[model samples]
Target: MKPHIVMISPALANANNGNWQTASRWANFLRQRHAVTILPSNDPETWSSIDKPDLLVALHARRSAAAMEALRERYPDVPSIVVLTGTDLYRDIHVDTSAQLNLQHAGRLVVLQEAGLQELAPAWREKACVIHQSAPSLKPIGAACKSRMPRFEVCMIGHLRAEKDPATFMQAAALLTSPGIRLTHIGGALDAELAAMAEATAAAHSHYRWLGSLAHDDVLHHLRRCHLMVLTSRMEGGANVIIEALMCGVPVLASNISGNRGMLGEDYEGYFAVGDSAALAQAIARAAADSVFYKRLAEQCQARAFLFTPEREEAAVQQLVDNMLNSKSTNRNPFP
Candidate 1:
């Protein structure tokens, strides 16, 4: 019989966030060789009915700490894997005790981007490996098709939360002078203040629209039709939106942060200073106005497309799991 794997994700399908997407996609990928199951949380009551999994994979160090600890106490020999997220690497691990404890309990650590590896301590770094997230590639919208549209549409996808920095995108909308440039925001308002801000911005700017909480397919459909995508997040482990945008051949204008740098590369030209609305506005206007610059951004994104292929990610995940299961050493660390 195939080994059973139980994955814990803080968010589920209804959340439509990166963590859920990662957990869902990974379960699909691993199901080819193992019996994979995903649980929203590792409640002891919930675990009581299920068999002890051969391996435990948890997303978000801090959020899943209790689950990891519970499993460790009950099944001392079972290896556990922790997939680090932006908050865990850039925030929680630095200040939160639970997040720190997760690092010690995990048998293996997974970072979504290469740059994420730098955030870990030397001992932890030795056991961690980067697994770039993947999205299925979509056919590129032809330039000829885009030229027929009356306006230059740009999109930002993420829940309206403080961490996503929706204010920067809204401020950019207010700063934009181009009559033909349109900005559309897709996401549910997780923060009431930000939701009100989005409503006010939409009412104030004729060129901006906030379409809250679109279906994943609808978001991608809209993304493929746009001239560009913008990501203004304060932090990201590796953004699923960036991968989706890249896969759809929609170039991105992202904040200049380590997570963004890890996704788009250090030399990518389409980055603005984090939280700088004016700079984001200028970048957006320039992309809309300068055809050559716009084309360059698309080309740069296309060059990096191979990194996010499903085949590569699936193989890496399989190898990681296989290595852990086959290891003979009592030490839980699998990667050399």
Candidate 2:
């Protein structure tokens, strides 16, 4: 019989956030081989309706800490895995009590990027493994062949939140003197102040647009058409957007944070200092003007494309699950 797994996620499909996307994708990835059920939260009352899961995978250490602790108490024999997010690794684990406790509670810990493992303490190091997120590849739209108005489209795909650093993109947009440069920001207004700022920026600059809250399909569609992608996020567990861009043969200009660096690699030439609009503006200008530089970024990204394939990700997940399950079970059944 297939093992039943319950995934606890703080956000569901309606949330339309990164956590939800990860939860949703992982559910689809695992369902072919296992019985997977996803719940918004880990409340016992909510889980009472279903049969006890053989394994539990909780996303976000601090957000699901209580549920993890409760699960351990209720099912001592069952093993649990905790997946760390950007906030959990960069912020919460540093100071939050519950997040710290989660490090101790989990039988195994999954970190989305290689840099994430650096954030954990020495003792927890052995238990943690990096699992780079995957996105389905999309064929790049032939911009030269398209009859649409020829503008150098630069796109940023994340909500207007502090961590996402939308302000930097706005500043970069304002600094760009290139009339052909069109900046498109695609995400919902996660913060009211940021939303107002985006609106104000859009009004001041005709080239800058705040196309808020696009569906996943629409975002991928836009991604393929853009000449370049920008990820100014201050933090990321491992940006699925970055992978999507790489998979689509679209290169990225990202902030020089560990998460971005982890995804793009340390030697990637397209990095600017975190929150530095001037540097970002300069980088964008160089990318547009210098054909050699643009080609280099594209070539570098193409080389890393193999790392984010669906087959590789599925194999990693299956191997991790098989090991965890085998460790727990005396029968040592081979993975389905």
- How well does model 2 score by local distance difference test? 0.86
Worst 10 residues of 2 by lDDT: 327-336
The best candidate in terms of lDDT: 1
Task: Tell me the TM-score of model 1.
Answer: 0.97
Q: Give the Å shift of residue 34 in candidate 1.
A: 0.8
Q: Candidate 1 at residue 254, lDDT? A: 100
lDDT string, candidate 1, 195-216, tens digits: 9999999999999999999889
Give all candidates' CA lDDT scores: 0.91, 0.86
246-288: candidate 2 lDDT, tens digit per residue: 9888889999999888888989999999999999988888887
- Model 2 TM: 0.95
| Clash count in backbone of candidate 2 | 1
Flag clash pairs in model 2.
187-213
RMSD of each candidate?
Answer: 1.3, 2.6
Query: TM-scores, in order shown?
Result: 0.97, 0.95
